[model samples]
Target chain A: MLERGEVANSWRHERWDSFRLLTPNWQSRLPGHRYEGPDPDGYMTMAEVTAFIEGFAARSGAPVRTGADVTSVRRAGDGYQVTTGGGEFRCRSVVIASGACNVPVVPPFAGAVPGSVEQLTPFDYRGPAQLPDGGVLVVGASATGVQLAAELRRSGRPVTLSVGEHVRLPRTYRGRDVLWWMDASGVWDQRFDEIDDLTRARRLPSPQLIGTDERTTLDLNALTSMGVEPVGRLAAVRDGRALFSGGLRNVFSLADLKMERLLDTFDAWAREHGRDGEVGPPERFAPTRAPERARLQLDLRGGEIRTIVWATGFRPDYGWLDVPVVDEKGRLRHEGGVVDSPGLYALGLPVLRRRRSTFIHGIESDAREVIDHLATVTLAQRPGA
Target chain B: MTTVANGVNVQALLDAREALKGAPEAAQFVWRASSKWQDGVHSTTRVKEFFGLGQEQEHKSEAVFDADHPEVFAAQDNGITPIEYLLIGLASCLTAGVASVAQNRGIQLRSVEAALEGKHDIRGILGVDSDVRNGFNDIKVTFTIDADASRQDIEALVAQSQKRSAVFDALTNPTDVTVEVA
Candidate 1:
C-alpha cells in the first residue's frame, strides 16, 4: 500500500498535543487487531493511537512504502496508472483511502481579518503555549474547535468560541459511553442506503464531544461554564472588526432539540431491549444558556484577540485525481464507496458505507465490502473461467 | 387526478421539484415588491411581477397592502406594520412547509396552527440604546398541530418544516442585503 509519510501520519501530525480518540479504546478494532489494552473505556492519546496503528501495520505485514507521495492517478488502458514521486504502478483496482480531511476550509472573510492577528487552522495548532499571549477566537464548535477552546480557556487564555450548526452529544449517557449505545442499538451500523437524506447526513458537522479520563461532555454550555464566551457563527469581517450572527439562541435551541431526540431514541432502545433496569435512569441536561444580547462584533485591531484558530471544517483535495468522478464541489460521487467510475473505490469518508464508516472500527466492514466488489469485477473480467 | 394530501398538491410539487433538478437555472427566483409612500410612517406595497423559470411572470393578480406604525408611535393607524408582515411571512412559510412535508410523509393533518411572537426592544430603533439591536431579540414560534399521527410524528413535522422553511432560514442565518439609492 502507498503511504504519504508513515502509518497514521495525520494522527501523528494533525492532532493537537492532548488530542485523543473520541471513541473509547474498546472500539479501536480492525479486521484482526482488536484493542486489548487495560483501559478499555478510556480514550487513546495521540501517541497511543499512532503506536496502535503502526503496530497494526507491522502485524499485518502489508508492504508499505513510507515516503512515496502520489502525484497523479489516471485511467490507462483497461487498468489504472498511479504515478508517485518514487515510481509508477499499474493496477486493475485502486482504493483511494487518503481520507476526507485533506485541506482546511476557511471562509472568504477570513482574509479580511487584520494582519495583526495571527491565523491558524487546527492543522497548525499544537497547544495554547504555541499561541501569542492574549485572548483567542476559535471559529467553529466541532470536536476540534470545542476541545481547543476549552484547552485554551484552561490555560488562562480568554477564549471566544464562534458556534455554527453542530451535533450536540454527551460523552456518556446512562452509565454507558454514547458510542457504546450507538453500537449496541444498531444506530452506528445503519447502512448509508437506508437513510433518506444521505446528502444532509454526509454534510453534517462532527458532534461537540471530547475524550477525557472522566468522560466529560464538552458542549457549548460546558464551554460557557468554563468561562469561554459563546458567540454565534462568524458572519463577516469588515474594517478590522469581526461580525457574528444574531441567531445564537435559535442555534442553541436546534442543537438541544436534536440532542434530546437522540437521547430519546437511546431510551426507547433500552426499554425495548429490557436493559433499562441495568443502566441508570434516563436523564436530561439543562438547556444551553444563551446571552440575551450576544456581542455582535469584536474589534480585531483592538489587540484583545491575538490569534484566530479556524476549526471550521475540511474538504478532500483531489487535485491529483484525473478521474471525472468528482462533483462540481470537488466531492467524490460515490454510492456506498463504489465510485461512479468502474474499477475505482473510496474508503474512510463520512457515511461512505454506513453511519459508522468514519470511525476507526468502521474500516473493516467497508474494506471487506469494497474488496468483495473488486473480487466480483475481477472475476467477471477474466477470460472464460 | 392530481394527488392531494393534507390539502397540498403533492404530485405537482414533486413534479416541479423533479423538473427543476434538471434545469437548475429555472429555479432561481427573484421575488419583487415595490412600496410607495402614502403618508407619514405609512406606505403601500404592491406585489405582482416576479422573475422565475427563465422569464418574468405575473402572479395572476396584483396584491397591494398598506403598512403603518401604531398610534403609540404617533403615526396614522393605516394597516399592519412592516414588522408584523415579517411575522406573517415566517408563519405562512412554515405553515406551508408543514403541510407539504406532512403530505410527503403520508400523514393526514386535521389542523395546523402556528402562533408567532417577535420580541423586539425598540430602544435600538429609537436610538436610545446603541447596545440593543434594531431587529427582534428573539422570535418564538409555537405549532399547535393536530394530526392523525402520534405526537412524536407531529413534532417531527414541525421540526422538519422549520428545517425546510425559507423564511426560517433567512431569519436564523445571515443574508446579504445590498441597498443602493439610484
Candidate 2:
C-alpha cells in the first residue's frame, strides 16, 4: 500500500478523478507522459470498487453475506473445503486475492502516543469523514505521505510532512506519460524462464514519484504550495510535539525501511536496464544512479513530536492462512505466481515479474499468468488439486 | 557530514602529501590460473580483501550466462564462483587422492560430489583491527560420495584427501595478495 501511496499521483494537477479516464482524450494530457492503459475500459470509482461485489449480488437479487471471515482451509481429496465464519464452500481450486496491503499494519514503535494528537493510517482513513481541527504531522513520505500531505493541506489541516527516501518518477520523457516506457520495456513483457537473476533483480521497474500535475516534482511542489512542511524521518513521539534527525526542534521519520527498499529496488532496476539505452546504466555503472550521489541522512531523534501516522507501507499478513506456499522471508516462493504447493495462487504482490508485479496496470498480466498455469489442472489431478 | 567552519589545515595537508612521495612501490605478483597436474593437484592464493566480498553494495555482482549457451548452473546468490571453484577442486582433489590410495587397496567407488561455500567479512580481510578480523570465519560443504566402501574405509580416504590436496595447502598458509595502483 505504501508502495502505491508514495507514487500514486504524486503530481500536483492530478485530481482523484484523473485515472478515472476510460477513453483516449485530451484531459489525460497533464497526467504525465504515459499510462498503462491510455484507453481504459472505464474508470471504476471508489464507490464502484466497494459496491462491485455487492452490486453484483444486488442486481441478481441474491441474498449475500458480508464481512464473513474464513476459519480454516483443508484439502478434501480432490477439491479443498474452505471453512468460514458463515459457512463452508468447496471448490476445485481457490484463488487468494488477499493483497499485500490488505492488513492494517502497526509498527511496534518504542514509545506511546499522546492522547491529544490524532494518529491514523491510510488504511483507517475513510475520506476525512471525521477529521479533528488540530494541526497535523503526516509521517512517511511515500505515496500516502505525499497524498495525505496534499489532502490535509487542501482541507485546511496544518500538515507537516517528513521526507524520507522519496521515490522519483519522471514527469515526462520527450513529452509522454512515464507509463509509456514501462509498457514498451519488458517491465510488463512476459518471458519468465529466460530472465536472468541479476537482470530480474536490477531491471525490475519501480513506480516512481508521480506529481499530481504530471509535471515532474509536482507532488513535492503541491504539498509545499499548500504549506505542508516536509520534515525528516521520525524518531519518536511524546506529549504533543515531535523531533527530527536534522536537529529540528521536534519531528519524526517519514517512511519505513521496507517501503524504501521497494522503491530503491526500482531505482536499481531502472539503472540496471540503463533505462533508454544509456551506456553504463545506473545499475551497471554505479555513478549513473541518482541514489548513489544522494547524500541522504535520517537522524531519528526528535524531542517534540506527537502522533505518528504510519503510512510507512503495507505488509500482507498471512497468519490465519495455514498454507505452505511462503518461504522463510514470509514471501511466496513461485515462478510467475505458480506456487510449489498445489492448488494455491497469489495476486498483486511485489516483484512478481521483470517489473510487472508493482503496478495495478501490470498486475493483470500476473493474474493471467496464474490463471493460465492453473487451467490445465483440476481437483481430480493432484492430491490437493 | 558536518563541515568545519574554517577550511582544512594546509600545513598538515602539505606535510602529509610530501611524506607520501617517498613511499616504496606497491607490491606485485604473477596471477597464474593453473589446471590440475597429473597427480590431481591445483593451488590458489588470494588476498583476504578478495577472499570474500564485504557488505559493500559497491561490490555487488551476479553471474550471468548466455541463454543460448546454458551451463551446469548460473546464479547470483551465495553460490561458488570461478575462484571458489578452486576450493571445490581442492576438495575434489582430496577425494581423488583418497580414492586412488584406497583403490590400490581394493576399495570401489560409486559416486562422488561436493558442494561448498565460504563466508567472510571484508573488515576482517582489510585488517582494520585485529579483534575485528576475528578468526576462520565459516566454511560449509556437503560432500556426498556413494560406494560399497564402509565408513571406516572412508575415514582413511578423508585423511588422504586432507593430506594431498594442494589447494588446501594454500588455505592453511595463505601467501599475501600483491597490490598496486597507477
Give the count of colliding residue pairs in each prediction: 0, 45
Candidate 2 C-alpha lDDT tens digits along B1-182: 12221232434545654664454232222223322222112222232222211221221443232111113333323333344555666676766665665554455566667777766565664578675544344444456777666764565455445545565545433334666663
Model 1 C-alpha lDDT per residue in residues B1-182, reported as the tens digit of each score:
23335788877988998899678899999999999999898999999999999999999899999999999999898988888999999999999998998898888888888899999999989999898889987888899988878876776677677767889778866677899997
| Candidate of highest lDDT | 1
List candidate 2 segments past 4 Å from native.
A1-44, A48-68, A76-79, A190-217, A237-307, A327-329, A358-360, A377-385, B1-182
RMSD of each: 2.7, 22.5
- Candidate 2 shows a clash count of 45
For residues A261-353, what per-residue lDDT tens digits would candidate 2 score against the true structure? 333454555566766354222321111111111111222234233334666766666675666776564666666666666777666666564
- Give the alpha carbon lDDT tens digit for every residue of A1-385 in model 1: 9988888898998888999999999999987897888899999999999999988999999899998889899998776899999999998878999999989999999999999999999989888899999999999999989999999999999999998788899898999999999999999999999998898899889999899999999998889999999888898898899888766766776788788889999999999999999899998999889876687789999999999999999999999899899997889999899898888999999999999999999999999998898789854685673
In model 1, the Cα lDDT at residue A202 comes to 92
The Cα error of candidate 1 at residue B135, in Å, is 4.0
